[model samples]
Target: MKFLKIILATAIVLCIVLVATDYWISHKAEGYLYSKVADIPKNKVGLLLGTSKYIATGGINPYYTYRIDAAVALFKAGKIDYILISGDNSHISYNEPDTFKKDLVKRGIPENKIVLDYAGFRTLDSVIRAKKVFGQYSMTIISQKFHNQRAIYIAKNFDIDAIAFNAKDVTNRYGLKTRLREYLARSKAFMDIVFNVGPKFLGEKIPIG
Candidate 1:
């Protein structure tokens, strides 16, 4: 009976901690998120965070489409001179950065204007690599609002001047699952900051002009 009570108490405390951490991260990123193209400040590079183009059900992922749209809009508006595609290339078949580049090209963005970082496996990697690997201390991050919030928080901790262009969000059943997962992700991000965790790969510097 005592063990059962202890387990319950522990679970409750963990839930509280998770919620608190989530709030802290979102609050920290409040002023850094932008939903309109005209309202956002210009930056030399726009960091296009990567995700799978298709979801598990083989449908086009709204998150991917929206991010690409956001990137294109930013470029056309003269808000950013270059688009930095950062994402995972873990498996031979999976190439997030390349996929994004191709789509951006198809959308009429010149190839030279888009640079790829094939090592952004996590949000932390994407944020850190933007500064360490790509020589960008200030950038406009592109993703959904929830994702942008977390990314902005990470950027602030790393001393990067970063703001986010919020892509249109998915609000279906899948979106609900993603939102729930974000709670745990926010907690993990907080711990990553506390522990001074760095990117998994920091290769030779690639200057972006």
Candidate 2:
């Protein structure tokens, strides 16, 4: 009975510690992203995070639509001069950067003002490479608020002056799942920073000039 009690106590303590750490990390990142367009400062480049246009249910992904919308608003408002679409392109058939470029162009954004990072397989990769590979020291990040917070955390670690312009967020069950997953992601972000994890692939420097 005593052993069981001790085990229960340990588990409870672990849960409490995890929840508190997750909250702290998110709180630290909140100050760097803005939901309102008027609050964000102008930057030469906007790092538009990538997501699949279609969900598993054979429907268009709301996350993808909202992010593109946010990126468009930023460009039209003159808050950002260029956009850098970054995402996983490990497989030729599933190219996120290409998909984003097509949608952005269809929205009347000139193809010349957009750049693609085909090797940005993850958020950490995108944020770090934005500085090391793309030569962008400061830029705006576009994604949902939860995602943007985590990206901003990674940016701070790399000494990149990054801020996020939040895209519209889905508020249903799907959004809840994303928000919950973000807690675990926040913890992983801390570990990645401490261990100094670098991007999987950073080819020849691609200056955004």
Candidate 3:
């Protein structure tokens, strides 16, 4: 009975820690998130965070589509001179950066204006690599609000000047799952900061114009 009570207490403490971390990250990022293209400050590079184009059920992921739309809008509005796609390429069949680049080009963005980082296997990697690998100390991050908040928090710790353009969010059951996952992710991010965790791969620098 005592062991069970201890387990229950531990669970409660963890839940509180998770919720607090989530709030802290989002609050830290409040002033940096913009929903409108006209309101955001322009940057030389817009870092489009990557996700799979399709969900596991074989439907187009709204997160992917909305991020692409946001990136295109930012480019056309002259808010960003280049689109740097950062995503995972861990598997031979999975190429997030390439997929995003193709979609952005199809949506009227010039191929030359898009840059790809094939090592952004995690959000931490994406945020840090923007500076360490891509030579961008300041950038406009493009993703959903929840994701942007976490990324901005990471950026601030790394001494990168970053703001985020919020992509249209998914509102279905999947969205709820993603949001719940984000709470844990935010907690992990806080711990990552505390421990000075870094990108898994930091290769030769690639300058972005």
Against the true structure, candidate 3 has what lDDT?
0.96
What is the lDDT of every predicted structure here?
0.96, 0.91, 0.96
Residue lDDT tens for model 2, 1-209: 99999999998987786688687767878778898888899999999998999988999999999999999999999999999999989987999999999999999899999999998888999999999999999999999988888898889888999999999999999888888787778777788988999999877899996
Q: Which pairs clash in model 1?
A: none
Q: After superposition, how far is residue 108 of candidate 1 from its true place, in Å?
A: 0.7
How far in Å is the alpha carbon of 162 misplaced in model 3? 0.4
Stretches of candidate 1 off by over 4 Å are none
Per-residue lDDT tens digits for candidate 1, residues 6-59, read 999999999999999999999999989999999999999999999999999999
Order the numbered candidates by lDDT, best leading.
Answer: 1, 3, 2
| Candidate 1: residue 65 Cα off by (Å) | 0.6
Q: Using Cα atoms with residue i matched to residue i, what is each candidate's TM-score against the true structure?
A: 0.99, 0.93, 0.99
